[model samples]
Target: MADWGAIGAVKSAVNIPVIANGDIIDAPSASRALELSGADGVMIGRGAQGQPWVLAQIAAELAGQVYRGPQGHALADVILKHYEDVIRFYGPDLGVRNARKHLTWYLERLEGGMELRNLIIRERDASVVLKRLTEGLKNCGPIIEVAA
Candidate 1:
């Protein structure tokens, strides 16, 4: 958790908006941060990694808006699309290497992810990695799609 007292102090001293960040992982935490720190808003870091839709979810909660995150087949589609984008942006060789970390993060919270994590990080071939991802997603169960 962030030092709310310090944030409050800073907010008082500054004319610009004060956005609190640190160890805020969900909408409730964000709301608490705003209340405690008297901040204009909150910023998320590690919490948003691999789970891109988290920010939107948090924002919606704060704004009292309705938002539905992708799940099941929709999640698989998003992950596949992200994989393809990474490959296209970096090209096969480097992209595969770079995407390993992202793939691991994406699978971390999934039910049967350890095996998939091993396969994804171990394989150097993009096609093989993608195939493994497809199979892994089948076994991983429901997933929340992270926006790009």
Candidate 2:
């Protein structure tokens, strides 16, 4: 559990803005942190690892808006774009290696995704990994369905 009390104490004492961070995964948690800590905002860390859209979701929920999140082809495009950008930033070899963990997180919740995840982490070729990721996302289920 997060030390929300500690955050509250800090918020009361500190002159600068306090941002509560730690285990603030979803809207409810974010709301709770803010309510208890008296902070300006909450900071999401690992929760946003693969599903970066979670930020939007949390925000929408806080504002009483509906956030369905990306699905199907759109979600696939987002994942692929992220992978490609990682590859570009780090170069083929380093990029592929660094992206393995992120890809794993992205597919962790997929139904029957273990095999694809295994292949993705072990495979060295960026093209092969991208192709496999695309196919797996398409054939399995909705992006949100597979989210861990």
Candidate 3:
């Protein structure tokens, strides 16, 4: 969790808009951070690692708008699209290496994904990685495991 007290102090001192960061993962946490820090907004780092739509989801929740996160095939499509974009921007060689971290993050919460994660992270070929990712996403069910 963020030191919202310190953030509040900063907010009290500054004239510009304050954006609270750290541990603001979900909508509830984001709301709490804003309330505790008295900030205009919150910034998320690790929280938005693989699930990039999280910030927008938080925003919608804050605004009392209907927000639905991607699931199933939709979520798979998003992950694949992100992968392809990274490859396009960085080229296959660097992109595969760079995207491993993001792919790992994406698979962190998935069920039956450990094997896929291992394969995806180790494989250098973008096409092979993509195929594995698609298959993994399709096969793996939603089963988030809490880290100890």
Question: How many collisions per candidate?
Answer: 0, 1, 0
**What tens digits encode model 3's per-residue C-alpha lDDT throughout 84-144?**
9999999999999999998888887677767789867889999999998887788888747
Candidate 1 lDDT over 14-98, as tens digits, reads 8998999888877898998889899998899888777788899998988999676777788777788899899999999999988
Deviation in Å, model 1, residue 72 alpha carbon: 0.5
lDDT of 2 by residue, 1-148 (tens): 8888789999888799999989898999999999989999999989998789999999999999989778778887988899999999999999999998888877775656666788678889999999898888777565544433
| Model 3: per-residue Cα lDDT at residue 127 | 96
Superposed Cα deviation of residue 121, candidate 3 (Å): 1.5
Superposed on all Cα atoms, the candidates' RMSDs to the truth, in angstroms, are 3.7, 1.8, 1.8
Candidate closer to the true structure by TM-score (higher is better), 2 or 3:
2
For model 1, where is the 10-residue window of minimal lDDT? Answer: 139-148
- Candidate 2 — which pairs collide? 109-146
Q: Please, what's the RMSD in Å of model 1? A: 3.7
Q: Where in model 3 is the C-alpha error above 4 Å?
A: 143-145
What lDDT does each candidate get?
Answer: 0.82, 0.85, 0.85
lDDT of 3: 0.85
